[model samples]
Target chain A: MLKDEELDLLTGLLSEKYGYDFNNYARASLKRRVGRLMAIDRFPSFAELLHKVNHDAAYLPRMVQSLTVNVTEMFRDPSVFKTIRESVLPVLGTHPLIRIWHAGCSTGEEVYSMAILLEEANLLHRSLLYATDLNPMVIENIKKGIFPMSQMKVYSENYILSGGKKDFSRYYTAKYDWAKFDENLKSRMIVATHNLVSDRSFNEFQVIFCRNVLIYFDKTLQDHVLNLFDDSLEKLGFLVLGSKENLRFSSISKKYVQSDEKEKIWRKMK
Target chain B: MAKNEMNGFKVVAIGGSAGSLETILAIVQGLPKSPGAAIIIIVHRKNDLESILANLLSFKTHLVVKEVEDKDPIYPDHIYIAPPDYHLLIEDEHSFSLDSSEKVQFSRPSIDVAFESVAEVFAGRAIGILLSGANSDGAKGLLKIRESGGYTIVQNPATADMGYMPQQAINLGAAQHVLDADALVATLNGLF
Candidate 1:
């Protein structure tokens, strides 16, 4: 694993030269991810690593992907998604049309998960889902909407746990090695690249999800991004975060009220 | 608790897994109502379940208990438990950070993850406790704590319901004090 000083030296340089501000990421999480990149790429030290990112074009994207740590799955923490289905969707149903933005939606599983929920709730026809991520590679993969067929059983179980009433197999077809989700679900989502670190919100949303992403940031960056979400969400619209994430520690905590505290789902109060 | 002695230690981290709840409760009941140092506990736990460990632990102690959240400030005297499915980390001296990163030692909320984090930031001023568990997760982390000049304690393996966790720490020479539950609490009290 890279030492704290090594991570500090590299992330500091990245922010100064590349406009990638990681100066505020939690030191330990940043250290852990950078260390994994070092082992994978076999870079001996931060000096050589930083030198590569400066001069080698290919290395910069790899470093960015490594630093972001975009590991996610469909209907992860099913109980939380179940909470969204049972409580949040009904309120969203009352609206004439709904706009949902999923920030840092790597692989687009949660976006698809939300589409599935909205579809079941009979809100899909009136809903537009926008999913964004910093990694173009994940966005490309998400656009394809193809996942390993071997993962279907697990995903099916997660679907049931998240309160899906339909036959999950109906939502997808199994080819030789992959399971392709229904294109109708795909059509409901618009996937693109939007860096939470630097991008501004493009549109307002009734529900915004930035789960498990802000944990990568330091306090200052987290505060900045929470404010970004605060700006994007309509008054009384819902915000769902990672089960581990909460509004309490952020400056905007008081701006939101708990809708489902256990799920980290809240409503904008002001 | 002596003022100076209490201030001597800035952080206390406890790591465990199976058969740890009883020991954790005993330690909570024995320690002063408001501990002097920031207290963090990490136990191997169900990956997808909402943890009530903090709530259960809070009921037995006077210190405020909270399952940790991302960016929670590390205040002294309160107790923080690693929430399920997230690896808890100390961002700086005064605050915590969490991530849904890959599991270590086949566990999220791995004892080693938190211990290693505490070791990185607090070092010599830290005190780490390794208690009854079925795995070797805390062994290397406890060794890190020891090498960093922090105090290390392991539950006595013979008395532990599941001894591998404590035994591994002992094999690594990680224990400065190896005691059963009550004695473990007594030692912490003695420090203050």
Candidate 2:
């Protein structure tokens, strides 16, 4: 495992070389990931890992990928999706143009899941799903819209659990061990590489899904991101976080209200 | 209670699966009002929206028991259960951060993930207990805690309902104490 000073030196080098600010990332998790990467790549020592990261330009993306957790699936936490379907969509549908942002969207599973929901609600044509992640590799995955065929069973189950009415298989075509989703779902999505740490919000959104991303950040970074979301959100716009995350204690808490007590969905009241 | 407040241990992380709930209940029922350390429970449960495990466990203990939310502060005498579908991690010395990333060992609340986090954050101040389970999720994690200079205890395989979990830990030489239910309670109470 990388010692505390070693992690600091490595993170400092990355910031200076790559211009990505990882200074505010939660240290415990960051250390674990760095340690895991070292083990996986078989770096004999922290100094060796540091030398590689400093000299190998092409290895930067791999290090970034390892550092950023990309674990996502279609329709994860079905109950949240169910709430979006039953409660969130009706409010969003009233607007002629629905702009939804999947902030820190990993591999586009949840974005595709949202497209399916919009299609089912007959709002796909009017909706634009903006999918963004820090990792360019996952952004490329979003463009392809292909996921492992082994995951189809679980994603399909999640779709059903989220109150999906049509045959889940209709949305994707199976070839070999991968499931390629319909092009129509991809048509309405605008994909981009965005860093929540430094990038300013580009456009206003009716709903922003930044689930599971803030947990990796420290309190200051979390507040910074939350304020960014608040600034980018329109009045009464929804901000959805992960199941265990909350806006109740944040500086912007006074400006928002939770959609439901159980759900993590929050709406900007102002 | 005052004596245990000065004890080296500050967090007790318990990992279990399958037939471990009964053993957990026995421990909870035997614990006093003040355990002098926070209890973190990581159990392999289905990805259901409505989980009653916290509520069920609350009935068995006087300590505050609830499903852990992201950024919830850890305190002595409280029991925090990992929420369903999220990998619970200690963010720092003070609070937890939930991860919805990938599952480890085919389980989201994988015992290894939590145990490793506890070992990193608490080090010598941590105690890990592996209970009855059908899988080998907690074996490596128990070893990690032991390696980090924390104490590790595994339920005696003969007394475990499923036994595979504790057996694996034992096989890996992870357990500082191989204990049955009664002896386990005695050991924990002694810590308090």
Candidate 3:
């Protein structure tokens, strides 16, 4: 167990020096992540780790990247995407310009998946997709629009299941082991770093997808993030989550009706 | 021991999605009424319905059993059950906070959310238990708890009504004790 003093010290250093506040994060998980970092860096104790994080600017960002959950895939929970095509696309298509935000977009798979879906629906020209993650490396990768070619078969299967109209293979070209996606799809996307924990809502979005990310956060953080999503979404905007995720219990749950409950799709009621 | 010494509570947070009620009951039956530490139970449900679990378990042990409420201070010898449709989390001061946020694992009061919160609040002092759940919700959080220096216990897959959760937890190298529910209670009792 981390001593109270150590927790306080680390919390203070993180806030004072880095402006990254993990003080509100679930305690045990935070300590564990800190402990792992300490062990990996060969710090004798939590105090030593705090000192290094306070003085060394690079260390804190690396630590934040490590602590943030980044596991994601293209067309993950394919049923949700299928629901989007059937239900959300018609509403979004009515608008002159549609802006969709993919928050906590780990590894950019979901963002790319969304881009492809919009392209297929003939809404790519009118859609502006913003993909954001706390990790700059992931944001950069999203811009590059390249993925491992080995995973293409599975992703293609998911694309088909998600009601893709075109051949999934046309979206990307295999160069050796990596698949570089078409530049046209990447052009519609704006990838950037936006820390959901500390950052405020910047732009109103017609649709918001923050699937599987809140599972990593504690209740308070989850509530905060949900509120951020709610604030960022325009009236009657669509919100989607992973198959294993739902908005039924949230403060905003009453504000959104299930467009397709099984697919985890919701339309803002308020 | 110094009375004023800051002694962190050795809290055990248990979460289960499906087939958890029986497993939890069996484990609770084996645990002492007053184990000198607290146990928080998070069972996934669709709504915030009234729970009879505390009443049911009260017959089995002398521990005080009740559903947890927002900002309720965690007490030793008490079993705090998480209400449905809310994600239960532990504060730094060891109180409880309920979040009605988006569901994980297709269920509110997700095992992963509860266990992850416990992992944050308790650190090495926290103990995470994965019971007979059908899904892989608790695996990552159990791994997090174990990685943080806390003790981790999983119901033995062979003994579980649904083995997926325990098996996944074991696969993740999260469980330090892969015991039967009865043995798990005994291990926890013996820890202090």
Number of the top TM-score candidate: 2
Off by over 4 Å in 1: A1-5, A249-254, B1-9
Candidate number that wins on lDDT, 2 or 3: 2
Query: Which window of ten consecutive residues has the lowest lDDT sum in model 3 chain B?
Result: B1-10
List all candidate RMSDs to the true structure.
3.0, 2.4, 8.2
lDDT of 2 by residue, B24-108 (tens): 8888788888988889999999767445988888889888997998788888889999998888888776789877666788888
DockQ of candidates 1 onward, in order?
0.61, 0.64, 0.11
Select the stronger candidate by TM-score from 1 and 3. 1
Q: lDDT by residue for model 3 over B3-105, one digit each (tens)?
A: 2123765787887767778878877887864677788888776441455676887777778887875556788878889876566766554577655454667
Interface RMSD of each candidate, angstroms, one decimal: 1.5, 1.7, 8.1
Query: Compared with the true structure, what per-residue lDDT tens digits does model 2 show for residues A1-270?
Result: 456789899989999999878999977678878988998999999999999999998999999999999988899888899999999999989999999999999899999999999999999999999999988988999999999999999998999999998899999999999999999999999999999998999999999999888888888889999999999999999999987788876899999999888889999999
TM-score of 2: 0.96
Best by lDDT: 2
Tens-digit lDDT track of model 3 for A6-119: 867887777777777766665544554566567777889766777777778878678777665555678876777888888889889999999999998977999899888898
Q: Give model 2's TM-score for chain A to 2 decimal places.
A: 0.99
Give the least accurate 10-residue stretch of model 2 chain A, judged by summed lDDT: A1-10
lDDT of each: 0.85, 0.89, 0.78
